[model samples]
Target: MTSPQSVYRAVAREVNRASISAPATRSKTIVKNFRTIIESGGQSNTEHFDHDLANAVTFMKSQRMYKILLERYNPLHDMSAEEKVKATARRVGLDVPLRENSDEGQ
Candidate 1:
Protein backbone atom coordinates (compact mmCIF):
# COMPACT_ATOMS: atom_id res chain seq x y z
CA MET A 1 0.00 0.00 0.00
CA THR A 2 1.54 3.26 -1.10
CA SER A 3 1.31 6.22 1.21
CA PRO A 4 -0.41 9.40 0.04
CA GLN A 5 2.84 11.36 0.26
CA SER A 6 4.64 8.82 -1.89
CA VAL A 7 1.89 8.90 -4.48
CA TYR A 8 1.96 12.69 -4.39
CA ARG A 9 5.69 12.85 -5.01
CA ALA A 10 5.51 10.21 -7.74
CA VAL A 11 2.84 12.21 -9.55
CA ALA A 12 4.84 15.41 -9.26
CA ARG A 13 7.94 13.72 -10.60
CA GLU A 14 6.21 12.10 -13.52
CA VAL A 15 4.15 15.12 -14.44
CA ASN A 16 7.20 17.36 -14.24
CA ARG A 17 8.92 15.12 -16.73
CA ALA A 18 6.06 15.65 -19.18
CA SER A 19 5.50 19.35 -18.42
CA ILE A 20 8.02 20.76 -20.85
CA SER A 21 6.31 19.51 -23.98
CA ALA A 22 2.77 19.59 -22.61
CA PRO A 23 2.67 22.99 -20.86
CA ALA A 24 -0.50 21.57 -19.32
CA THR A 25 1.44 20.22 -16.37
CA ARG A 26 -0.51 22.20 -13.82
CA SER A 27 -3.80 20.83 -15.08
CA LYS A 28 -2.33 17.36 -14.98
CA THR A 29 -1.28 18.02 -11.41
CA ILE A 30 -4.87 18.87 -10.55
CA VAL A 31 -6.00 15.64 -12.15
CA LYS A 32 -3.45 13.78 -10.04
CA ASN A 33 -4.81 15.48 -6.94
CA PHE A 34 -8.33 14.53 -7.93
CA ARG A 35 -7.20 10.93 -8.22
CA THR A 36 -5.80 11.20 -4.75
CA ILE A 37 -9.23 12.31 -3.60
CA ILE A 38 -10.85 9.19 -5.08
CA GLU A 39 -8.08 6.95 -3.81
CA SER A 40 -8.86 7.99 -0.26
CA GLY A 41 -11.90 5.76 -0.85
CA GLY A 42 -14.61 7.71 0.78
CA GLN A 43 -18.07 6.76 -0.46
CA SER A 44 -20.01 9.82 -1.46
CA ASN A 45 -21.02 12.55 -3.95
CA THR A 46 -20.46 14.46 -0.76
CA GLU A 47 -17.03 15.53 -1.93
CA HIS A 48 -16.99 19.19 -2.83
CA PHE A 49 -14.11 20.08 -5.10
CA ASP A 50 -12.55 23.54 -5.20
CA HIS A 51 -13.99 25.60 -8.02
CA ASP A 52 -11.04 27.96 -8.36
CA LEU A 53 -8.64 25.10 -8.83
CA ALA A 54 -10.99 23.50 -11.34
CA ASN A 55 -11.19 26.79 -13.20
CA ALA A 56 -7.44 27.10 -13.24
CA VAL A 57 -7.16 23.58 -14.58
CA THR A 58 -9.83 24.31 -17.20
CA PHE A 59 -8.11 27.50 -18.35
CA MET A 60 -4.76 25.75 -18.57
CA LYS A 61 -6.34 23.06 -20.74
CA SER A 62 -7.70 25.73 -23.06
CA GLN A 63 -4.38 27.54 -23.28
CA ARG A 64 -2.61 24.31 -24.07
CA MET A 65 -5.20 23.43 -26.70
CA TYR A 66 -4.90 26.79 -28.43
CA LYS A 67 -1.14 26.79 -28.12
CA ILE A 68 -1.07 23.45 -29.88
CA LEU A 69 -3.52 24.71 -32.48
CA LEU A 70 -1.79 27.94 -33.38
CA GLU A 71 1.81 26.95 -32.89
CA ARG A 72 1.73 23.46 -34.37
CA TYR A 73 -1.22 23.65 -36.72
CA ASN A 74 -1.84 27.17 -38.00
CA PRO A 75 0.97 27.68 -40.53
CA LEU A 76 -0.33 25.27 -43.19
CA HIS A 77 -3.91 25.15 -41.97
CA ASP A 78 -5.23 28.19 -43.78
CA MET A 79 -4.29 31.54 -45.31
CA SER A 80 -3.68 34.48 -43.05
CA ALA A 81 -5.93 37.52 -43.43
CA GLU A 82 -3.25 39.32 -45.43
CA GLU A 83 -2.66 36.26 -47.55
CA LYS A 84 -6.36 36.01 -48.28
CA VAL A 85 -6.41 39.64 -49.38
CA LYS A 86 -3.41 39.00 -51.60
CA ALA A 87 -5.13 36.01 -53.14
CA THR A 88 -8.18 38.14 -53.83
CA ALA A 89 -6.00 40.76 -55.45
CA ARG A 90 -4.46 38.10 -57.65
CA ARG A 91 -7.91 36.89 -58.68
CA VAL A 92 -8.76 40.47 -59.65
CA GLY A 93 -5.70 40.60 -61.97
CA LEU A 94 -3.14 42.13 -59.61
CA ASP A 95 0.48 40.95 -59.71
CA VAL A 96 0.31 38.54 -56.79
CA PRO A 97 2.38 35.54 -57.80
CA LEU A 98 1.18 33.30 -55.00
CA ARG A 99 3.90 30.69 -55.10
CA GLU A 100 6.59 31.83 -52.73
CA ASN A 101 8.88 29.06 -54.02
CA SER A 102 8.70 30.02 -57.69
CA ASP A 103 12.32 31.14 -57.70
CA GLU A 104 13.43 27.96 -55.94
CA GLY A 105 11.42 25.78 -58.30
CA GLN A 106 13.63 26.92 -61.20
Candidate 2:
Protein backbone atom coordinates (compact mmCIF):
# COMPACT_ATOMS: atom_id res chain seq x y z
CA MET A 1 0.00 0.00 0.00
CA THR A 2 1.35 3.39 -1.01
CA SER A 3 1.13 6.41 1.23
CA PRO A 4 -0.27 9.71 -0.01
CA GLN A 5 3.22 11.20 0.21
CA SER A 6 4.55 8.48 -2.10
CA VAL A 7 1.59 8.93 -4.38
CA TYR A 8 2.18 12.68 -4.46
CA ARG A 9 5.83 12.19 -5.31
CA ALA A 10 4.98 9.82 -8.12
CA VAL A 11 2.42 12.26 -9.37
CA ALA A 12 4.98 15.04 -9.24
CA ARG A 13 7.44 12.96 -11.25
CA GLU A 14 4.80 12.37 -13.89
CA VAL A 15 3.91 16.03 -13.76
CA ASN A 16 7.54 16.96 -14.39
CA ARG A 17 7.63 14.67 -17.42
CA ALA A 18 4.31 15.76 -18.86
CA SER A 19 4.45 18.73 -21.19
CA ILE A 20 0.69 18.55 -21.32
CA SER A 21 -1.17 21.44 -19.75
CA ALA A 22 -3.58 19.97 -17.24
CA PRO A 23 -1.24 17.87 -15.13
CA ALA A 24 1.34 20.62 -14.97
CA THR A 25 -1.29 23.09 -13.94
CA ARG A 26 -2.52 20.68 -11.34
CA SER A 27 0.99 20.12 -10.01
CA LYS A 28 1.62 23.83 -9.77
CA THR A 29 -1.65 24.36 -7.96
CA ILE A 30 -0.84 21.58 -5.56
CA VAL A 31 2.57 23.04 -4.87
CA LYS A 32 1.03 26.45 -4.25
CA ASN A 33 -1.48 24.94 -1.87
CA PHE A 34 1.29 23.16 0.00
CA ARG A 35 3.19 26.38 0.32
CA THR A 36 0.14 28.08 1.68
CA ILE A 37 -0.52 25.33 4.13
CA ILE A 38 3.09 25.34 5.22
CA GLU A 39 3.16 29.03 5.96
CA SER A 40 -0.33 29.47 7.28
CA GLY A 41 0.47 28.59 10.87
CA GLY A 42 3.90 30.15 11.13
CA GLN A 43 5.17 33.73 11.36
CA SER A 44 4.69 33.93 7.61
CA ASN A 45 3.28 37.24 6.44
CA THR A 46 0.32 37.31 4.07
CA GLU A 47 2.04 39.65 1.65
CA HIS A 48 5.14 37.50 1.63
CA PHE A 49 3.07 34.46 0.87
CA ASP A 50 1.15 36.24 -1.86
CA HIS A 51 4.29 37.66 -3.39
CA ASP A 52 6.02 34.34 -3.31
CA LEU A 53 3.09 32.56 -4.85
CA ALA A 54 2.79 35.18 -7.56
CA ASN A 55 6.48 34.95 -8.36
CA ALA A 56 6.42 31.19 -8.36
CA VAL A 57 3.40 31.14 -10.61
CA THR A 58 5.10 33.47 -13.04
CA PHE A 59 8.25 31.38 -13.08
CA MET A 60 6.23 28.22 -13.40
CA LYS A 61 4.37 29.78 -16.30
CA SER A 62 7.62 29.99 -18.27
CA GLN A 63 9.08 26.55 -17.74
CA ARG A 64 8.96 23.61 -20.13
CA MET A 65 7.06 22.10 -17.22
CA TYR A 66 4.46 24.80 -17.48
CA LYS A 67 4.18 24.58 -21.26
CA ILE A 68 3.94 20.82 -21.17
CA LEU A 69 1.34 21.06 -18.42
CA LEU A 70 -0.53 23.84 -20.17
CA GLU A 71 -0.72 21.77 -23.34
CA ARG A 72 -2.25 18.99 -21.29
CA TYR A 73 -4.45 21.59 -19.64
CA ASN A 74 -5.09 23.56 -22.82
CA PRO A 75 -6.70 26.54 -21.06
CA LEU A 76 -9.40 26.56 -23.73
CA HIS A 77 -11.42 23.77 -22.14
CA ASP A 78 -12.84 25.33 -19.00
CA MET A 79 -16.53 26.13 -18.59
CA SER A 80 -17.79 29.11 -20.53
CA ALA A 81 -19.00 32.11 -18.52
CA GLU A 82 -22.58 31.35 -19.47
CA GLU A 83 -22.25 27.73 -18.40
CA LYS A 84 -20.74 28.77 -15.08
CA VAL A 85 -23.61 31.16 -14.38
CA LYS A 86 -26.16 28.51 -15.27
CA ALA A 87 -24.37 25.97 -13.09
CA THR A 88 -24.41 28.30 -10.11
CA ALA A 89 -28.07 29.03 -10.63
CA ARG A 90 -28.85 25.34 -10.82
CA ARG A 91 -26.91 24.60 -7.65
CA VAL A 92 -28.97 27.18 -5.72
CA GLY A 93 -32.23 25.79 -7.15
CA LEU A 94 -32.89 29.00 -9.06
CA ASP A 95 -33.22 26.80 -12.11
CA VAL A 96 -36.86 26.01 -11.41
CA PRO A 97 -39.04 28.75 -12.78
CA LEU A 98 -41.37 30.21 -10.18
CA ARG A 99 -44.13 31.13 -12.62
CA GLU A 100 -47.24 28.96 -12.84
CA ASN A 101 -48.48 27.81 -16.26
CA SER A 102 -51.72 29.78 -15.66
CA ASP A 103 -49.90 33.02 -14.82
CA GLU A 104 -51.33 36.17 -16.32
CA GLY A 105 -48.10 36.94 -18.17
CA GLN A 106 -48.91 33.96 -20.37
Candidate 3:
Protein backbone atom coordinates (compact mmCIF):
# COMPACT_ATOMS: atom_id res chain seq x y z
CA MET A 1 0.00 0.00 0.00
CA THR A 2 2.38 2.63 -1.23
CA SER A 3 0.98 6.14 -1.02
CA PRO A 4 0.06 7.91 -4.28
CA GLN A 5 2.51 10.67 -3.44
CA SER A 6 5.28 8.09 -2.97
CA VAL A 7 4.47 6.52 -6.37
CA TYR A 8 4.57 9.92 -8.00
CA ARG A 9 7.94 10.66 -6.38
CA ALA A 10 9.36 7.36 -7.66
CA VAL A 11 8.23 8.11 -11.24
CA ALA A 12 9.61 11.64 -11.01
CA ARG A 13 13.00 10.38 -9.83
CA GLU A 14 13.28 7.97 -12.77
CA VAL A 15 12.27 10.73 -15.20
CA ASN A 16 14.89 13.07 -13.79
CA ARG A 17 17.56 10.38 -14.11
CA ALA A 18 16.63 9.85 -17.77
CA SER A 19 16.69 13.57 -18.47
CA ILE A 20 20.17 13.91 -16.93
CA SER A 21 21.64 11.03 -18.98
CA ALA A 22 20.06 12.09 -22.32
CA PRO A 23 22.51 14.89 -23.06
CA ALA A 24 25.49 12.71 -22.23
CA THR A 25 24.21 10.04 -24.61
CA ARG A 26 23.61 12.61 -27.34
CA SER A 27 27.06 14.12 -26.79
CA LYS A 28 28.71 10.73 -27.16
CA THR A 29 26.85 10.08 -30.43
CA ILE A 30 27.85 13.48 -31.81
CA VAL A 31 31.48 12.92 -30.88
CA LYS A 32 31.48 9.53 -32.58
CA ASN A 33 29.99 11.04 -35.79
CA PHE A 34 32.52 13.89 -35.78
CA ARG A 35 35.42 11.51 -35.40
CA THR A 36 34.13 9.38 -38.26
CA ILE A 37 33.87 12.44 -40.53
CA ILE A 38 37.42 13.55 -39.70
CA GLU A 39 38.79 10.09 -40.34
CA SER A 40 37.04 9.83 -43.71
CA GLY A 41 38.27 13.28 -44.70
CA GLY A 42 41.84 12.20 -43.99
CA GLN A 43 41.40 9.11 -46.15
CA SER A 44 39.98 11.19 -49.01
CA ASN A 45 42.91 13.58 -48.77
CA THR A 46 45.36 10.69 -48.92
CA GLU A 47 43.68 9.30 -51.99
CA HIS A 48 43.71 12.69 -53.70
CA PHE A 49 47.40 13.12 -52.86
CA ASP A 50 48.14 9.68 -54.28
CA HIS A 51 46.29 10.51 -57.49
CA ASP A 52 48.19 13.79 -57.87
CA LEU A 53 51.51 12.09 -57.29
CA ALA A 54 50.79 9.47 -59.93
CA ASN A 55 49.84 12.14 -62.46
CA ALA A 56 53.03 14.08 -61.66
CA VAL A 57 55.08 10.95 -62.16
CA THR A 58 53.42 10.27 -65.52
CA PHE A 59 54.05 13.84 -66.68
CA MET A 60 57.68 13.66 -65.56
CA LYS A 61 58.16 10.44 -67.49
CA SER A 62 56.63 11.96 -70.61
CA GLN A 63 58.89 15.00 -70.32
CA ARG A 64 61.90 12.72 -69.94
CA MET A 65 60.87 10.78 -73.04
CA TYR A 66 60.48 14.00 -75.06
CA LYS A 67 63.94 15.13 -73.95
CA ILE A 68 65.45 11.83 -74.94
CA LEU A 69 63.79 11.91 -78.34
CA LEU A 70 65.01 15.47 -78.93
CA GLU A 71 68.54 14.44 -78.10
CA ARG A 72 68.57 11.15 -80.01
CA TYR A 73 66.66 11.93 -83.20
CA ASN A 74 66.90 15.73 -83.69
CA PRO A 75 63.90 15.57 -86.01
CA LEU A 76 64.45 19.00 -87.57
CA HIS A 77 67.96 18.02 -88.59
CA ASP A 78 67.45 14.34 -89.41
CA MET A 79 64.07 14.19 -91.16
CA SER A 80 63.21 15.37 -94.68
CA ALA A 81 60.15 17.63 -95.28
CA GLU A 82 57.83 14.75 -96.17
CA GLU A 83 59.19 12.59 -93.37
CA LYS A 84 58.62 15.42 -90.91
CA VAL A 85 55.04 15.86 -92.02
CA LYS A 86 54.34 12.15 -91.78
CA ALA A 87 56.04 11.87 -88.41
CA THR A 88 54.06 14.83 -87.06
CA ALA A 89 50.81 13.41 -88.31
CA ARG A 90 51.63 9.96 -86.91
CA ARG A 91 52.50 11.45 -83.52
CA VAL A 92 49.11 13.18 -83.48
CA GLY A 93 47.34 9.90 -84.48
CA LEU A 94 46.23 11.25 -87.85
CA ASP A 95 45.78 8.89 -90.80
CA VAL A 96 46.84 11.37 -93.51
CA PRO A 97 48.69 9.44 -96.17
CA LEU A 98 52.44 9.83 -96.73
CA ARG A 99 54.23 9.76 -100.11
CA GLU A 100 54.73 6.00 -99.89
CA ASN A 101 51.10 5.29 -99.11
CA SER A 102 49.89 7.78 -101.70
CA ASP A 103 52.10 6.20 -104.34
CA GLU A 104 49.78 3.16 -104.36
CA GLY A 105 47.30 5.20 -106.39
CA GLN A 106 49.75 5.64 -109.29
The CA lDDT of each predicted structure is 0.56, 0.54, 0.53
The whole-model C-alpha lDDT of candidate 3 against the native structure comes to 0.53
- Deviation in angstroms for 50 in model 2? 0.4
> What is candidate 2's lDDT per residue for 1-106, written digit by digit as tens?
3333443354455435544566535547755555455446234565665555445444644575666677586644467887666767887888744556686766
- The residue-level lDDT of candidate 3 at 63 comes to 64
- TM-score between candidate 1 and the true structure: 0.30
Candidate 3 lDDT, 1-106, residue by residue in tens: 3333343344343333434356545445533543454345445566664455445445555666676688687856667897788778888999665347766788
RMSD of each: 10.6, 14.9, 26.7
TM-score, every prediction: 0.30, 0.28, 0.29
| Backbone clash count, each prediction separately | 0, 12, 0
lDDT by residue (1-106, candidate 1, tens digit) is 4344554455455445436656643566555675676466433432342333344445656666776788685553478887877867877899765567767878
**Candidate 1 residue pairs that clash:** none
Candidate 3 residue runs with Cα over 4 Å from true position: 1-44, 75-106
Off by over 4 Å in 2: 1-43, 65-106
1 or 2, greater by lDDT = 1
